[model samples]
Target: MIQELNDEQLERYGRHILLDEIGYEGQLLLAQKRVAIIGLGGLGSPVALYLASAGIGQLTLIDFDQVDLSNLQRQLIHNQQRVGQNKAISAQQSVELLNKNVKTETITTKLTDDELLKITKQHDLVLDCSDNFETRYQLNRICHKCQIPLVSGAAIRWEGQVTTYDFRKNKQPCYQCLFPLKSNQGSIQESCSQNGVIAPLLGIIGSIQALEAIKCLLELPTLAGKLTIIDGLTMELRQFNITQDLSCPVCS
Candidate 1:
C-alpha cells in the first residue's frame, strides 16, 4: 500500500522534495527503502546519518565492536556518553534522535553466513564500512549471491576509496574481483588501528557511498562498476572503470 505524506512528513523532508532528482516522489521512494549497514565506525557514521536524513524507511546497524574513546575523533555519530557501548546500539540511539520516522535494527553479535544472508536479503541495499578484509569479502559474497546492491567504503591514513557493486545483474564485478582472498591482499590487514586515518577521509568516502545508495534506489546513474579513490592530502580524486574478472571466483 502506498502512503501519502502527512503534513509533518512533508515539512520534515521539504528540502529533499524541492530537488529535481529527489522530489516528493523520490522522497517517498526513499521512505520505502530498507538498508543494512555493516559497520558503525567512522565510515558507517556518516552513511547512517545521511541515509536517515534522506528518509530511508528501515536501517539495520550491525557492528559487534564496542566504541572506545579514540573513536570520538572520527566516529561522529557517537558521543562521549556512548563510549563502551556496542557500536550498533550506540548508532541506533543516535539515529533515533536524528529521525523518529526511521526504523533501526541493531545486531551486536558476530553473524554467521546464514544469519548475514538472512539480514542482507531483507534489505534493499548493504553498505560495507567494515575495517577488515574478512568482513568485506564475506559481505561481497553474500551480496553477490543474493543479487543485492552493495556500497563499499574504506579509509586509511590519508586515502579512501568507495565503489558500488551492483549485483542485480549476472557477471558483475564485485569486491572480490578488486581484492581477492587467494592473494596476500586479504592477509595484509591495513586498518585505522594500525594506519590511523585522517578525520575527514571517512566522511568523504562514506558520504559518496550514501549518495551512490540513494542513486541506486532512485534508478539513477550511480558509481556502479566504478572505483573512486581520494587523497585527502592532495585532494585529488581519481576514478577507474571496474570490469568483471572472468577468472574471479565470486562473480565469474
Candidate 2:
C-alpha cells in the first residue's frame, strides 16, 4: 500500500507527481522503494544523486575505494574536500544533502559474491555501476537468482552503454547472457582510468541508469531486453535487442 505523502514530500516531488505517468501514486511507490547502487564512481555518482533526489526511501551504497583528485573529473558526488574518504560514505553524505528523507547506508568494504547476494536480496532494485566485468557478471548471476531487476551502465572513453535485466520476467536476457562470462575470460578489460573518458559521457550514461531504475521501481515499461549504446563523439544513439542465451548458465 502507498503511504500518504507529507507536505514536504508533496512539495519536494511536486514535479514528479504532476506527470501522468508518475502521479502521486508513483511518487509514493518511489518513496517506499529500496535501491542498492553497487559503485560510487563516475556512473554511480549521478545514479545515486538522481535516485536520492527522487525520494527512494532507502539507498544502499557499496564501494571500497576512496575519493581521489582524479575522480573529480567525472564523479560529481564527491568534491576535493572529500578526497581520501570512502566513496560509499561520501556518496551517502551527498545523498543525505540531496534528500534527508531518503535513508542512506554505506558498505565501505568490497563484498564477496555471497555477501553481495545477501545484501542485494534486501533491496527492490540493484544498479550495477561497478567498473569491472567480474563484478557485473557476479551481480547478474545474483540478481537473476533473486529475481530482482538490475540496471547496468558503463562509460569509457567517448562511448557508453546502458541496459536493464528484469530477472522477474522469465526469458529475459541478463548481463551474462549478453556478454557470456567465458567469452570475457583472459580478455583485457579497459577502464576509464586506462583509456580516459569524457566527463559528460558519464553524466549521460549514469542519468540513463537512474531513469531505468526509477521506471523499474514504478512498475513502468523498461528496457529490460535491450541495450542502448551512445557514441559521444558523433552524438549517435542506437539500441539493439538482447536475446537470452538458451544454454547459458546464469538466467536460462
CA lDDT of each candidate? 0.92, 0.92
lDDT of 2 by residue, 139-161 (tens): 98899999999999998889999
Score every model by TM-score.
Answer: 0.97, 0.97
lDDT of 1 by residue, 25-118 (tens): 9989988889999999999999999999888999999999999999999999999999899999999999999999999999999999999999
**Global Cα lDDT for candidate 2:** 0.92
The best candidate by TM-score is: 2
